[model samples]
Target: MTSTGAPPDWTTVDIAVPRRSDRLPGISMAGFRQRVPSPVDITMVAHPAVTLLIDLGEGDGIVYDTPGRHERGSVVIGLMPGELRAGGRVGDCLQIRLEPDVAAAALGASPELSGTIASFSDVWGRDAARVEDRLRAAASWDERFTIAADILGRRLDARSPVDPEVAHVWRQTLTSRGRARVDSLAGEVGWSRKRLWSRFGSQLGTSPKRAARLVRFDHAAHLLAAGHAAARVAAESGYVDQSHLHREVKAFTGLTPSAVAVAPWLAIDDIAWPASSPTRNPGTDSPRHRARELGAGGCHERQTAVRDHC
Candidate 1:
């Protein structure tokens, strides 16, 4: 869901989802607001397979390339729109799409092309200045979004679909209460573990279990960010205990639950929830509740950021 706060005077923003042929029939266009700052915030947006970002024209920006999964964050500057090589970060006011290649590159693999620009530098080198010039010259946010989407569409192609069974199992696992049993999911999907993994890996670019963990971690991050107690978050997120939740949090984000709970730039509320909020009975301290707790901090931070940025 998009934030509904007061709109920015100089910038107008909207999100649209193109038809997707991948794991799901649709994709989410997460919206963000850009704030003027003394020392700019370098945001990291992660998505499954590939993530996409576009510049909304609040200011001059840069994109950095970095090794997938590397510990140290890298920085790039003065990047124009187009395909970027693996291993970089973007500057303020730039819209970013974590494309499949970028996702692959981040996961330490060579990216497979889908007719999009093969390299970030190559794309940026040619059109950055022109795009920026056009954006600056344009009078409205609608125009900027239109132009940016056109450029992105030109560079990117639709993602291929995963096996239906595999997709089903994945969604089930994500929406499940706690650590999903692989065998159980396999049974429900009518596939063996090996078969499921093979199909899932080929299509989703990550293991089903890993994907579930990521989804769960995302949930936990949201709850923590939303100001929920760690113990409550652990229970709600399906952790065996708070320690288990903490361990997973550290693994995914390199921060303790408390630290993530207060992360300045993390927007827990912005992360998409399942189509329906997963069922969680009040008496049962399910993993879902734990995940919701993490969101508390993230939601608060997002609200504050939106106000400051707007």
Candidate 2:
């Protein structure tokens, strides 16, 4: 979601992170303190990360939507969701992204929740209220982060992990920005291609080839948001050319390259995540988020990046 010309009642700040220390093998956490009483509607595109948005707001105004489901307050956003719309008077929200491997344990049902969005209450059950209360009572952002980390860590520890080979396949796909070949990954994992594909899909809810393409598209999208020419971004991101890039962008986000170039969510990546975030912007290009059309809705303010593989 994005802000307009008006002075918003709420503003958000990023926690000072020590390098990638906040980066976990199967998970990453970002701290955001948003105090808001806004009326802006946000158009959230599909992100590679399975996101958990913890709303520590004062009221029940924060609304999250996707197809048939419409939830207020806290929600868990599964991977590759269609455009999600969120807006309300949310106060403090903690957004966490987990790799499917670790996510199997952390959120309890993320793997099954793939391609969909659900409220925290739906996924975490009774503990959802208790966790939100704990976060609200936290004294500082650091404390909040610690509490979140502990909660997720405990859950992850409690659940069984995906095979090491499965984890390896995901990591390779992400590190290569989704350009890694599924056949290569299967070979490296020493499993038959069919076996690897079956396991990856069962555990991650996406086929290996689709995951690779999704990550690649995500990389191209960020590059476009950074203001690189579509041609250059396409080439660097391993797309055939600008036309191919266009097709892929539309396939996933349902928006043209120019439209995605100014998405408000991609605009705030540098600010929300600085040192630990991986984006290349040297200030020559700037995203024009004021342009009011992203698929069927508009971006309101901040959104998390999908660096799930990293």
Candidate 3:
């Protein structure tokens, strides 16, 4: 399913999603096409999953920057990549989000890579270019998703997966919206606190506490973007108070709740990532039906569109 354009002023991008059968557990994919050729720049909000941004456009398709670092084209962004921005003339780009456990199995990288960005080539070697070439040659979004899913499935199956116990803990953390306690989780998984902590950190590249905070912050950010009041969001999201929410939001994106509320990045979630809500299951409507309900079947005044460049 896909949505074309929101409010012209809000966004100028078109979004496409895969069929339900194309989705993999703990993985979400979105395709973005820019409607205009003007250069684009966007602040990439931190997300709870490891993200793969595959550039399908020619010539400096996408450029990402963090303090003291710059990378062009396809890149893998880790959880909490502090203060990052993506810019450049993008034509077609595919974004893939992977749960950390799935990422660990697919990427086979160490924990140290989780809080930073890595070039696609650095992770996949020569296969990165080959895969991009195939994706670029595909005729439709569905084809690209199929190829991408096949690749991920192969890699995931080839590797020795993270411990089942660790995977369970991560799922618990997510299902609880980051409210699950580490000690309790460890007990449920039949591991001691220290073992669970060490194993989880080593396998997932983040501690249980940090994962919870990121998951919690992500939920709150979405609520804020969805137009909820900060005070109410703080209360609903399990914060100590409004002040705690402020501090955490600041720590995550270096922005206040108010600023984050209207952020273009978060604004696209309803269309680009409709299945990501922590409190809800994926919608039951057909993709086309859902798109219509979202008023995304066509443009209307004040509607938000994904820009032609991302």
Candidate 4:
């Protein structure tokens, strides 16, 4: 797939969108290489404003570190820090879902919940040690996720309920409009601008407008991956112009639209299609649709320069 060579002895199969569950709407699955015996370094990156993570797979654990060093294997159950970044090796890891509440909780005021999930060695308490032990003892990816979910569920349940109206407004603004006017969203949520900011800051670690932008970026990435043009995707995703789209794509993904389109790794052929959903197919574009497509040209040349230099 994608000319990566018969799949590495251990390959990661990631599914960006997952079927809805009673608790979470979306899921991301990461299938680790079974043959790799030692931890293989990997990175987990997210769009700005989204901070929660779910560990559905295997290996020692995930480590959240700063510029130079990092903590080793640790299972992070609650909200991740605002600047939390993941780096570690994955082995037999399955799936993880970042729930809204977990994300919100991490954004709330708490010393233990500030930034990324690090190893037990990085933290200072007995609780962290216990968690480390449990994670290491876990046998499978499912077991790890189960423990993580339980810990997060407890932490979330202890927090005060968020205003349903505000949450509703946010959901609507994100899913339908792809952007939110802070003043307008505040009005719909029956809160003052200050109050709305406080709520969003404490719950999302970012403002509503910022969160909306991240959501919009996610949608845009999907469209680009589906072979849509930059101009069309920009309009559909609520950007002002193709240049704006390009800027945002570069900032979030470190790649331009055309580069992402032509990258062998981003090709549809590189992924394993889930079989349960008959409605979903990776490369089922009609001949007519393919005919109207513009191949990645200029952007490809620029990306080639970056790759060659690296």
RMSD of each: 10.2, 7.4, 5.5, 9.8
Per-residue lDDT tens digits for candidate 3, residues 1-310, read 1111222233366677777777899888888777666677677767889999999988867888888889999999887788787778878889898999988989887375677888999987779999999999998777888889999998888999999999999999998889888999999989999999999999999999999999998888878766688999999999999999999998887778987765655545666686564332243232211233223322211223443222
| Runs in model 1 lying further than 4 Å from the true structure | 1-25, 30-37, 41-49, 56-60, 65-139, 143-160, 267-310
Among all candidates shown, the one with the greatest TM-score = 3
State residue 185's C-alpha deviation in candidate 4, in Å.
1.0
Ranking by lDDT: 3, 2, 4, 1
* Candidates in descending TM-score order: 3, 2, 4, 1
Displacement of residue 191 (Cα, Å) in model 1 is 1.7
Where does candidate 2 clash, by residue pair? 1-300, 1-301, 2-299, 2-300, 2-301, 10-35, 57-91
Candidate that beats the other on lDDT, 1 or 4, i.e. the better one = 4
lDDT by residue for model 1 (147-258), tens: 5556545433443334568657766765573368888888898899999887766654566676677667666766665668899989988888999998987665555788
State TM-scores per candidate: 0.57, 0.84, 0.88, 0.62
What's the CA error at residue 149 for candidate 4, in Å?
3.5
lDDT of 4: 0.46
Instruction: Candidate 3: list runs displaced more than 4 Å.
Output: 1-11, 278-310
Predicted structure with the largest lDDT when compared to the true one? 3
For residue 38, model 3's alpha carbon misses the true position, in angstroms, by: 1.4
Task: Report lDDT (Cα) of residue 187, candidate 4.
Answer: 87
lDDT of 2 by residue, 1-117 (tens): 221112232233322221243356666665554433445456777666788888876766578777888889888887777767776665677777777767766666756778888
